[model samples]
Structures are given as C-alpha cells and as structure tokens.
Target: MKNLAWLSLGLMIGQFAYADPIENGISFTSGDWEIVCDNTRTCRAAGYQNEDDGTQQPVSVLLTRAAGKNQAVVGQIRLGATDTDPTDTEVQMKINGQNFGKVSISKDGDFLGHLSSAQVEGILSSVKKTSLIDFIGKQQKWRVSDKGVAAVLLKMDDVQGRINTTGAIVKKGALTEANVLPALPKPLITTVKVKSSPVQWNSTQLSQLRAALKATFKSDDDACSMLTDPQEGASEISITRLNDQKLLTSALCWRAAYNEGYGYWVIDAKAPYHPVLVTTDASDYQEGKITSAQKGRGVGDCWSSESWAWDGKQFIHTGASTTGECKAVAAGGTWNLPTFVSTVR
Candidate 1:
C-alpha cells in the first residue's frame, strides 16, 4: 500500500518502513540496511552504499537465513556498473581495509556467487560496528555502509527467535541452536483449475458490464472510472470460466505513461450478475490467478507485486513482495525481497 513518496521519505529520514495493509509480514528498515521476514519466517537483510557517496559506484550485499535451528546465513553481493567483464575480474571483499577473499562471478549480471561460510561469518562480525565494507574489482570499488546493519540484523534475530542463541546473527549466546524457533510451514493453497479458456464479452455484454461496475465506484473521480471512457476507443473486458457456477472478469481500468492497471472481479455467469470487485489496480490475470505489479517510480528501477488465487470458494492473497529500495541499482531494482510468501499447490 506504500507509494513512491512514502518510500523516499522513509529512506531519507532514516525511518523504517513498517508492514502496510497490503503487505502481511514484517517490513523494516534502518539507515543503509533493511530486512524483510516473509510469512514463513525466512529473513533477508540487504545493505547498500550510502546514496550520498557519489565518488564510487553502488555496492550492495544480501544476507539470507530461513527460520529454523542452525540454518546457514547465506551471503550474496552485487556490484554496480563496471568497465571490465565481471567473469574475468576477481571481486574481493575487504572489511575495514582487511582482505577477506575473492567471490565468484554469478550468471546474473553484476551479482557475485554466494559467499563462502567464512566470508559470511566475517561479515556477520564486522557489520555490527562502524566498519567500512568494500567490494574491490578492476577499476571499481563499492563501499557499503555499516550504519544500521547491527540494528537490522538484531531485528532479524528477534523475529526468527534466534536472539541469545548460538546461531544468533548479532546477539550470539551460550544457548544451543535447538532453542531457536523452527521454521513455520508454508501456507498451502490448492488452486482451482480453469474450467475453460479465456473469452471476452460481446459488445452488448460489454456495455452492460461497464455500467454495472461503474455503479460500485465510490464517486465519478474513482481512478478506475476511466472504464467508461478509456484513453483508447473504449475499455475492454475479458471473461473466463472459473467453475461451473462462477466466472472471472477483467477490464482495462486506467493507464499511465509506462504502466497500466486492470480491474478484476468474480461474478455469476448468468444475469443477477453480482460483481465482487477484487482490485481496480491489478496488473494481469491468468487462469484462476490475479496479480498486480506496480513501479515505485516511472524508471522501472524499483517495483512491487502481489498475487491472488481462487481456491474453489474465493480468491485469497497468495503473495506480496518488493525489490529493495530504488537506489537505481538495476532496471528491476537491486533485490527480489519478499514481505509475504506462500506455496500454491
């Protein structure tokens, strides 16, 4: 439910982005580092170079740990634009000027392979204090800030119930990892099979459907009110059979410079069509699932998305996530961080 303005303000003022109505799990940020714990309790901590530091390119790191006793804390690194080939270049991490070792290149551009356990441990110890984190490559050196990293990792530890345990990332103690909380099982969702392929409404049905949906809007200024008169010739609607008794519908709701939105609803196939509006800002619909993808800004550097699925009875939120802050790291943003996750059967 957050927008570009709120995201920018939170980062600038060093305010944490708490879980919003759209997001179900824990969403927190502090300084140059932030962490997200999904519904399954898996935590991901991302740290970046201070945006104000213009002298060098952006260098970032990702640390991930699933909820459970003794789960390994995996580390990943990403570098900003460079002149040389990443494969041929040897990228090494240096904590406070101490060389840890080189990290392997990854198939994903700008991202290095998973860090070795030793490298991860070194990072866990160094990131807690006012240390300078650096990733060195040919003609490139990315310095990540240590500010707020300790607080973020501590929060991760707290959420995972790892605090005061041997496996705690920030507050390690004498307690055994067995004392830490176990990972929760992923929520299971049995998807409804599509009874038939997609089909659009005829001209007669289209006009009636539009009028019916317009009636549900709060006012003439509702964003989706564009359904009456789209920027194009007219709005379009798609109908698909959800089951023998119900039908799924989609229609063009609004448009923007680089992105668009759709309205999704569940309705009866016959007259007395009780259109149950799902969302007016959905991005796409397929089979028995509905999804929405929105950009933090027009550049497409940062993004967020959520999904809903039919489970025979009704649509349920399946997942919601966002790439880390829009630091202009890459086109789709720096990381695939999720605030909510689920396993759909």
Candidate 2:
C-alpha cells in the first residue's frame, strides 16, 4: 500500500512538472482514472472503457464539485458522441454486483446525480473493497474500476480544498500542494507618456490627415468603408507625437458581429505618412513597443499574444506568450486568466 501510494504520488507530481503550463488544465492519473483541474480549481475525474466491437465510448463516470462550494459533489456519466440523446430517464448504479440506487438523467442528455459528503464516504468505502462498479443508463453501460474511481475522487476532494479524515485517499507531503492550480499573471497595461503641451491639429491639417488615411486604405475597399461609413461608430482616429521628430497616427472602426473591426493602424513619421498596419485584435503602445492580445472563443481555449518593438525602420517581434488549453469558469471570470507558454525578450 505504501509503494502504491508513492507510485501514485510520483505519477501525479511528474505530470504537474513537465506538462505544458500553456495547457492551463492540470491533469493527473491515479489507477485507471485521469483527473483534470481547470484554472478555477474545479476538477473532474474520468475513466474510459472500450466496447467489445472496439469502439471507444464515454462509458466513464465524471465527478466534479462546484468551485468554492464544499456542500456536495456531482457525478455524471458522459454519453458517447455517437450515443442517442437520452430523454428523462433513470440510471442504475451498482457496486460489487449489489444495487446502489438510481440517478435521474435530464432531458438534454445529461446523466447527473449529487452526493453529500456522507454519501461520498459511503461510496469510497465500497470502492476500496470492490473491484467493479457499474453505471447502467437507458442506452449505455459503464463498468468502472473501483480502485481507480476511489483514487480519483480523493484527488478531486483535495483539489476542491476538502480534507478526507480517512487517510486512505488524502495525499501526503509535496503532492498535497498539487491540488491547487497556479494563478495566472495579471493583464499587462501599457503606460502612455502624457505631454504637457500636446500637439494640436488645425482644420486644414486635419483634412490632410483624413485624406492621407483614406489613401492608405485605397487598395482595400472594405477597410476604406470604415472611414466613409456614417452608420459605423464615430471614427476612432488620433494623432500623437512619438518624439521630437516622429509623429504617430491611428484609426479604429468597431464592427457588429463578434465585435469584429477594421483594426487600428499606426502611421509613423509625418505627412506622406508611412503607415504601418497594426493587425492585432487588441493592442496597446508602451515603452516604445506595441503589445497585442488575441482572445480565444471559449473556456479552455488557447490565446496568443506578442510585443513588438520598432527599430528605426520596422517593428520587430520582441516577445510572445501563448497558453495551452484552458476553460473559463464563472468565478469572477478567473478562469479567463492564461498560463504563460513562453516569454522571449
């Protein structure tokens, strides 16, 4: 038993160490169960089984507790991708061939049930003594490994900051710290230098600036439409002095769907302005460099961002950060934080 515990600890720590930080999700294996924890510290434990016909199905049961909620843990039997949608149905559960009880499946194909802490303790007792536990839904059957299920549940409890009085499952030593996922770095904000005596543009100069911007996008009708369209939000164009000799101009147009847009542009130098099209989804200028971020669509999504520094003639990519798969949770949008993949300066 001690050897088994040590082996489990080794596997868990090994996974935590080398696994890509970019993959904001932390996963570890105990017996046949694989446990995954998201940035919000909500975790799920799952195990898969293959059918006799060699088709792999989501015949596994998944367990998770709500973030920061220690009242109850929920269990769900995942329906395979190709499985027929289940209407309201009853799922039968058994431990060591003895009937446990029935859990209700919702209309939207969700096979879920709740377990109080006492109920979890009862199940853990059975799992420690049994080898097979079965989940029989109306159209699916999952035979779970008892030891694996027990180990995963213990780890899940740890991840949610729960302590199991029975040392049977609680991790000891360094492995205990692995329960909590690391917090993501704060968002980077660019600092703009404010000028006491800012440069002001007159009507004629402003007209020349507008003409120059329209000319820059002349080759692309879609981009030019942003400056000419009245329905679009007010033109977001501005000019600033980069230094005593260089001047900077920028324009932005926010679109409708998905908050799409004709992104901002930064034109360096003066009239007959040399425009350098900045194509990042979002950007900020600070410390003589442009930092940009591209947000992902959904939780557990990956994001890519970079910083570019201008070197006299052109902007060069100076640093970048990318994250692995991450899923967002609703705890103040904490899961939206991204794990750094790499940083190069």
Q: Against the true structure, whose lDDT is highest?
A: 1
- How many clashes does each candidate structure show, in the order listed? 0, 6
Where in model 2 is the C-alpha error above 4 Å?
A: 1-25, 29-32, 51-57, 66-72, 81-88, 110-123, 126-130, 137-140, 145-345
Deviation from native of the Cα of residue 25 in model 1, angstroms: 1.5
lDDT of 1 by residue, 91-166 (tens): 7788888989998767656565568888888889985456888888776677888877877887788778777788
For model 2, residues 170-202, the per-residue Cα lDDT tens digits are 443333333433333323333334231235777
Error of 2 at 182 (Å): 12
TM-score (all chains, Cα) for each model: 0.83, 0.42
Candidate 1 has an lDDT of: 0.78
Q: Output candidate 1 Cα RMSD.
A: 5.8
**What pairs collide in candidate 2?**
22-324, 23-324, 299-327, 299-328, 300-326, 300-327
> What lDDT would each prediction earn against the true structure?
0.78, 0.50
